[model samples]
Target: MKLYEYEAKEIASRYGIPVPRGKLARTPDEAYIVASELGSTVIKAQVLVGGRGLAGGVKIAQTPWEAREAAFKLLESSIRGVKVNIVLVEEKICVSRELYLSLTIDRAMRKPVFLVSEMGGVEIEDLARKYPGKVHRIHVDPEVGYSDYMSRIALSALNLPWSSLSELSSIMKSMYRIMVEYDAELVEFNPLAYSCEGKLIALDAKIIIDDNSLPRHPDLQELYGRELTSYEKKARELGFSYVELDGDIGVISNGAGLTMATMDSILFYGGKPANFLDIGGGASRERVREAVKLMLNHPRTRVLLVNIFGGITRCDEVALGIIEALKEVSQVKPIVVRMLGTNEEEGRRILLEQGISVFVEMDDAVKTAVNLTLK
Candidate 1:
């Protein structure tokens, strides 16, 4: 589960990290009030997704009126489909330098890794790709924990001024402690700024807690549960994994691996997938119908692609589910299905009877779905 920037900053502050004074505002009036108190303020959209800055979700306001205007523009807008109902109005800082720092679990190494970079205020992926040498990584030994020596090594990589080293290292250690205490998968401070006053402050934050560990933290679970979209909440209730995407081709598959492959095939064939919906293995006809209904309900979905490679889930049952789904949903979108493996012939026959063409190969199915979108 991911926390909004404001929430992450609040948590980090509790852990002794220095962050700019900020207030959450749900209305333009509230923003004006906060900005008036803070003077020059940065009004930031409170969304759970990234690229918010690039999407015009972050704005600088030199006055309360400007802050109010910025908040008015952002409050009802959607950033990458996630509605921005609130904005974080923070005092704008004068930065002498920007740095990056983060702590995350490295699944490959099965240990927590600390990432530090002198380059900040931009996408870390792009930074790493463009200047891999600038970004430093340290794999922490869980048994040894994050010691002062590890902190020194991580700090040395940035080559920051001697004056900032102690504060930066302390912040890093505090972040590590937060990750451990909260069971966070990721805790990051991008643009960890060295202000004109020569103090290190976290200008931006992103925190993602492990979903499996949510049960251990009731407060975090509640916070994240409240952040879920209506569709996301419904998907969770249906026991399906669904993620919204920015495209018209809705995709459905029985397993995570196959679902990913189906989306990849669509992209490979010059198509974009609207969502990733995995119905999981051994889905019943009713579950499949629900999945189909869910896909059809998406406003951006112009076409649906159901790709099933049945093993425990029989192809014939999937076909029946699709047929049943078509009967139930209104304003049914165009559906292209690809079924292979168990009872494949019977499944194709059933779909054919319903005037639905079935593809034996994934590439062919994806190509057809993409073409239908052009029509």
Candidate 2:
């Protein structure tokens, strides 16, 4: 669950982190109104993905007229395939320096890692590659998140003045605490700039929360779901990617890693995975049914693949779910099933009886699935 920049900034502001004043605009006229209110603002297209500046998603304007022009241009554009419909009109700060600060879950370590650098505004990966020494990282225990001691360590690592370090450190710790409390995967503030007047302001903010944990955070749920259309909210609520793609193979998987692998495998074997869909763990029959219906309805999906590596998930359950889903949809397209792990035999039997292709090996399944798609 990715929160738009404005949403993230609002959250940060609640934690006493300084963020530039901004307003979300749904229309060109609204954008003009916001620009007029902000007076000398930076117009930024709000999207879930990164590299917005590189994609011309961010632009500065000295007046409301220029701001409206930038808004019109960005709102009419697409960044990395995501249509820019919403724009953020924010106050442009006079900065003495740009810094980077972020708190993100380190999957490898199963803990949160705090990152900071003097060289900001540039991508963190680029900084790591070019000037590894400039970037500093420290891992925090999930149980004992952010503390004053930890904040001191981060501030010391950044080599800031003693007087300014306390306030900056507190803000950084608060951001990290928010990340943990909100079940955020990545909470980042890039070019966390220091104004000429000595105030730290977040110039760019991004927060990617774990969708699996949204149920626990009602506030965030309300905030994000507020603007989403009914269909978009329902799609996300079901834990699936309804990303429209120009491909023929609609993919469905149980895990994020598995979903990515399926997409790559399809491409490798000369088939295109229409979209990334993860039904999530322990998907009920109805949820599975909804997923199938959603994929089959996709105009670009000529074929479907339900590939499951049932460890905690049962193959028999997936099989039954797909059957139930098919019963609801009057017409179904070509589907390939590869069931492995728990209840594998029963699952394979049910699919085979339905005249569907089933495979035990991943490579074999992918190859056969791609062939079916090409047909």
Candidate 3:
């Protein structure tokens, strides 16, 4: 699950990463109080999604009254459609240079990789995309763990000042530690700035923890109760891995890898995925039913795509779940099923009996589902 900027910064501080002096405020009066203490503050809307600044969710305040005005404006607004009830009131930093640093799993290599960009900030993506040579990537072997040299080497190639090497390396190591300690999918420090005072500080923080690993971290569970979307909370309660998206096709698969592949297949076929729902290994008929019902209930899901390469999960069970879910939900969205592996024939027969055609080829099923969306 994605964390708010303040929460990510709090975790960074615990790891010895320097972050701006800040506090969360829910009211304009609280913002005024915090700004008075900190002076020259930045008021940022607390939202899970990105592009908050572009959405006018971030504002600078030179005075306490301005801080109150900034907080009032943000708290009354929505950032990328998510309501902002809280704002991070932080002391403004005068930066000499802005840098980007992040660590995330490189699925292709099955290892963790650190990405660094000298030309960082809001335009980092565009800079790296248009000029790939500006971004330096450092891959760390998961078994060996991270060392100081990994970041140092990447920074050296960017021609970063030698004086700041030690501090920047320390920050990078802390970021790696945070990712491992919290089972995070991503830990990012955008604008890991070198301040005018000759110190490094994280101006912005974003951490995405693996939702499946939340069970192991009870302390992080408290964030979910208030932070997660309604559909996300429901999916968690049902024990299915789910992520909401902005598209028309809702995807369901038995494994995380397959679920991702299904979404990719949809995209390749010119279809957008509305959500990712992994029923997980050995999914029961009830879980499948719940997954189907969940997708059908989503207003954005115009079509359902169920791709099952069943093993521990039987195909018959998947078919049974779909049938059961259809009975429970009144939403009449089109469902496309592609079943293979254990009990494949039985599953196909069950769906066929109900006048639903099952596809043997995943490509054909995906294509049919994409086509159905146009109708």
Candidate 4:
């Protein structure tokens, strides 16, 4: 789950990381009130996705009236097709220097990586590509978290003045500690600023908590009150949740590894995965229907792929779910299923009786799905 900048700043503030004072506003009038209270504020559109500034969703206003005007223009606008609903009015900070810092998991290395850069106001990816040398990354032990040596290394990489090094290092340590305690997958601070007086401040924050680890942090759940889609709400109610991705093929798999592999397989065969849908073990017909319906709602989805290597989940049960889902939706795209495990023969027989296409071989199923996607 991702926390908006306001929420992330709240969490970071509790740990002594200096962040700007801000308030969330749902209306232009509310934004005016907030700006009046804060004074010389920056009105930022609140959205889960990134690239808000480049999309003109961020505006600096000298007065409450200007802030209200900017909020009115931004509130109903779409940044890359996603509607903006909330705006954050924050006190604009004066900066003598800017830096980018983050603590995130490196799945490939199975460790947490600390990223530091001198160019902070812009997107990190752009800086990485244009000036790779300006960006410095270090992997740390997930169990131990960031140490003093790591903090010093990150601070040095920022190339800040020697006088401000201590404050910068302290802020980096605080960011790392928050990542460990909150079970955060990403804790990013952009334009970590150095004021004229040598004080450090966090200009913007982006945090993504580990959904799988939410059980341990009830406090986090309350802070992350971002709106959920109806389909996602239903899935969460049923003890599972999904987020739609941009691709042509929708996937349903038993586990995360298998789900990712299925997506990769689709890509390997010249097709992109529309979403990552993990039915998990012991999935029933109802769960299957929900997953399928969610996929069908995706505008980019052109094909469905059900790749199940049943361990505890029987192949016949998964097949029945697929059939039931087909009946529930008014219209659905082509489906290519690959079932191999317990009751594989029975599952294939049932699907064949319905005249549905089923592929026992993974290679053939992926190829067929790719072809269908192209069409």
TM-score of each candidate?
Answer: 0.86, 0.77, 0.79, 0.83
The regions of model 4 sitting more than 4 angstroms off are: 106-113, 137-155, 222-229, 239-243, 246-250, 260-273, 289-303, 311-313, 326-335, 367-375
Candidate 1, residue 331: the lDDT equals 66
Per-residue lDDT of candidate 4, residues 1-375 (tens digit): 898888899888998899888899999999999999888999998888888889888999999999999999999798767798999999888788888988888889999898889888889889889999988988998778667788678768987667776776778788888888888899999978877667889889998999878879987676443556655566566665455567889887778888888889888989888877787887777887777776766667788888887777777887788888888887658888898878888888888888777787888998999998787
Q: Report the CA-based lDDT of candidate 3 relative to the real structure.
A: 0.88
For residues 1-375, write the lDDT of model 2, one tens digit per residue.
788888889999999899998898888788788888788899899987778889889999998888888988998999887789889899888998888889987789988888888888998889889999998888898787676777677667666667777788778788887887788898899989878988778998888898778889887666665444444566788766555456888888888898889889989999888887888777666777899888877777788888887776777788888888888786668888887777878887887888877888777888887898766
lDDT of 3 by residue, 241-353 (tens): 88888899999987889899999999999999999999888878998899999999999999999998876678898899999999999999889999887898899999999
Per-residue lDDT tens digits for candidate 1, residues 1-375, read: 898898899999998899999899999999999999999999999888888889999999999999999999999799988888999999999998888888988899999999888888878888889999888888888787777776677667776667776787788889888888889999999988879998989999999999999999998777765666677778878999988778899999978888998998899888899988999888788898999998888888999999988777788889899999898889668999988778888988999999999998888999999999988
Clash number by candidate, in order: 0, 0, 0, 0
**Candidate 4: residue 328 Cα off by (Å):** 4.1
Give candidate 2's error at residue 24 in angstroms. Answer: 3.9
Clashing pairs in 3: none
What order do you get sorting by TM-score, best first?
Answer: 1, 4, 3, 2
Off by over 4 Å in 3: 103-114, 137-166, 169-173, 183-185, 210-215, 222-228, 245-251, 256-274, 281-283, 301-316, 332-375
Cα lDDT listed for each candidate:
0.89, 0.82, 0.88, 0.83
> Order of all candidates by lDDT, from best down to worst?
1, 3, 4, 2
The CA-based lDDT of model 4 is what? 0.83
Better of 1 and 4 by lDDT: 1
In terms of TM-score, which candidate is strongest?
1
